[model samples]
Target: MTETRFYPKGEGMTLAELAALCEGELRDGADAGHRVDGLAALDDAGPRDIGFFDNNRYAAVLAETRAGGVLIARRSVHLVPPGVAALVVRDPGRAFALAGRALFPDALLPTGLELGGISDRAFVDPSAVLEEGVIVEPQAVIGPRAVIGRGTHVGAGAVIGPGCQIGRDCRIGWHASIQHALIGDRVILHPGVRLGQDGFGYSAGRDGILKMVQIGRVIIQDGVEIGANTTIDRGAIRDTVIGENTKIDNQVQIGHNVRVGRNCMIVAQVALAGSVTLGDGVAIGGQSAVNNHVTVGDGAQIAAISSVAGDVPAGARWGGVPAKPVRDWFREVTWVSEMAKQRRVPEVRHGRDDNDA
Candidate 1:
């Protein structure tokens, strides 16, 4: 259970109300009037909490949960024990999430210090423009000519560099450094997110490794959430654009001139080299690396730990080193493993070679 001191539950809702909110159906003499105020795992839920079961691995636990109500698929309704009200839904997981939001709305966003307005200890540049309702915390530095929109929260120690433009209702997390970026509304830059740093581009001149001037900016569209410690570089000639609604996981390194389309899911520890382009709905698994100048088309999925060296067509599923189609990759792996296994056979004494010295 979440501690009440840290997170308070919303007003309690009746079982009927929950069913309505989740588009679930309460069946078989369910006590619609029963009140629920908390949500918990099936194994830990008490009489006042709601629990959800989606996977068959938890079928045993579902039978014994003490929750006031349980969200389950129609096929599993028979597993519910007596005295427990079952809310039937197409997807138990989705229903549970909906119910959770209804009961714990505050848990939707990242928690931060509730500094109401500009802190007297913070430094706001004389030329910087901050709209009404913006909250700037202590030790934060807003550079000259920077514009932060209304209802945004700048967390402690955050540095909004000179000439940056941030839109409304955004949350700039603690210690985040934003330079040469234009971010849209409802964007969430989690703690330690580094945006618009110089890209890794250099030219070999007579003077030895000459660093190229990174003149472009990072453009983050609306509803984009960049996880903690993710660094996106500013482009050398064009803007590095992250499209709307892309959810990037923690520790991702997106290099210069990369264009990530809308609704893409990039897992943790993924590294995209400079000029890589990802179309809409693309999903790159954890620890994958996309080499520079490669493009992954829309709806493509690359498996975890894959090393992508070339372009992937739209709606493809690829995996393994130098990633290709998943089936081909698996077949090649199988063939190599079989050959290795064959080589492991011992050279019997009865089969001594004629050329043996």
Candidate 2:
């Protein structure tokens, strides 16, 4: 069983209410008035908690789950234990997510900065323009000529540097710094995110490495959510652009002049070197890295911890240190393992001195 953590419980909802909220059909085992007070994993769920089962990998766990009610696909409705209420849906995960949002609305929305308007402790420059309904938290700094649109919230200790153009309904998390950037609407920058920093550029010189002056800006499109501690550097020449709805995970580093297309999913600790271009809908796994100037085609998937050195063709699934197609990589691994198992040890020579030769 999964260990449970204590989260403040919300108002209890009846089985009928949950079914209505999630658009699922409630089976007739449990009473409609049965109260569900919390949501939990199958192993951790109690009589008052609702759980979800989606993946077949956890079939054994599903059979043994103690949840009073379980959300499951219509095909898997028979797997529910006797006495447990089955909420059948097209997608159990999606239904469970909707139920979670309905149950824990406060956990999903911003809390500290939502109710309060601009904080008295925040610093807004006289030349900077903030639209109506913008919320600036305590100790946040807004620089000269910065334009922040309506319904944006700048969290505590965040810095909006000079000449930045932030769009409407954006949430800039605490300690995030943005400079020389044009950000689009509904973007969410997590805590410690640093955007528009100078790229790593140097020129060979007789004296020492001469730093090149970065002149270009960072452009982030709408509906993007950058994770905590992610760093995106500005371009040396052309602008660094992140397309709409790209979901980047925590600790990702995007170098200068990089172009990431719409709907790309870059997992945690992924690194894209300077001038790297990713096409739309690319999914890069955790800890993966692409070399400088590489172009990854649309819909390509890079496996976890892979090092990509060249272009990946569209719709390819690649993996390994020096990545290759999934089939090729698996074949190579199998061949190597077979070779290792069949190899014979070299015959050991009796003690002989090199001087004899």
Candidate 3:
């Protein structure tokens, strides 16, 4: 029943092999030799496709699953069907992810071309230096004196500006424009990612707004994955730094000179203003905005649609407008909601008001 495959799939693996590959253990005397050839959801997975159940919302369907194998937590092992093999782990979601990664490695990380060779339609300047095993696709432009490291793939219509240095095994997506930037190894720049562009720097005076020439660079460290259509502006004086292993979602706007710490997670539509500093392991929810010059401490969690106008302490959970402590925000919201429920309390003394629902 599996159809419409976009990429090549790996060979089928046995239940024992999948368990070992995902660092999981089989439970309830499951047959270790059962073969699983595809991946799918619990309802769609067949006898040959592996499925996963980690969320409470899908608990009801676990008992009736027709799949031969299921990845689930130790606590949920009892819910597995009698004939199915249960692969128990501490984090079933992560284990399932590992299984998917092993089975379909290319799907997780798409290497545009399997064979390492530059396309004839691609344009590499005579002064550019491409290391061995680099793959350049059609319409890609590598400018003068650009140095692309080994095993990197430049997709169609991608533009690597002059003198830009990219490390090995990096993937530059289609139509991505990189200039005045230094990128590290294993970085993935998704389609339409615009880096090292002019920052929004202007001084207002009697003579009108004076644009400050953005001369600094953008430094993207190793293993950082930037999503599609996200724009990281070039620093005005120093450099816009995206720390190692940080994953930024789509449509993010990171202003000039913003320093994002390692392993930080910035969700989609988030805006980090110029000169803002995000400490390591911080996670900001979608559409959150951090004001300029604000510093978010390590491990801080900012809720979705929140605005941070001040410094956030380390490990604190903050939410709401102006972004205060979560508890305080909840309390304030609860109070306002409760207070609003008493409709026309002031008018009660003068006249009885009609109840409106």
Measured by TM-score, the strongest candidate is 3
Residue 154's lDDT in candidate 2: 92
At residue 198, candidate 2 shows an lDDT of 99
Checking candidate 2 for backbone clashes, the offending pairs are none
- The lDDT values for all models are 0.94, 0.90, 0.91
User: Could you tell which candidate, 2 or 3, scores higher by TM-score?
Assistant: 3
Per-model TM-score versus the true fold:
0.92, 0.89, 0.93
Residue clash pairs of candidate 1: none
lDDT per residue for candidate 3 within 115-154, as digits (tens), equals: 4599899899999999999999988999999999998889
Displacement of the residue 134 alpha carbon in candidate 3, Å: 0.6
Per-candidate RMSD vs. true structure? Answer: 3.2, 3.4, 3.2
Evaluated against the true structure, the overall lDDT of model 2 is: 0.90
For residues 1-357, write the lDDT of model 2, one tens digit per residue. Answer: 343343367777998999888888888767788898788889888888889988888888888888869999988888888888998888888988888888776565333555468888999999999999999999999999999999898999999999999999998999999998999999999899999999999998899899899989999999999999999999889999999999999999999999999999999999999999999999999999999999999999999999999999999999997999989999999999999999875554577544455
What's model 2's TM-score? 0.89
Residue 84 in candidate 3 has what lDDT? Answer: 87
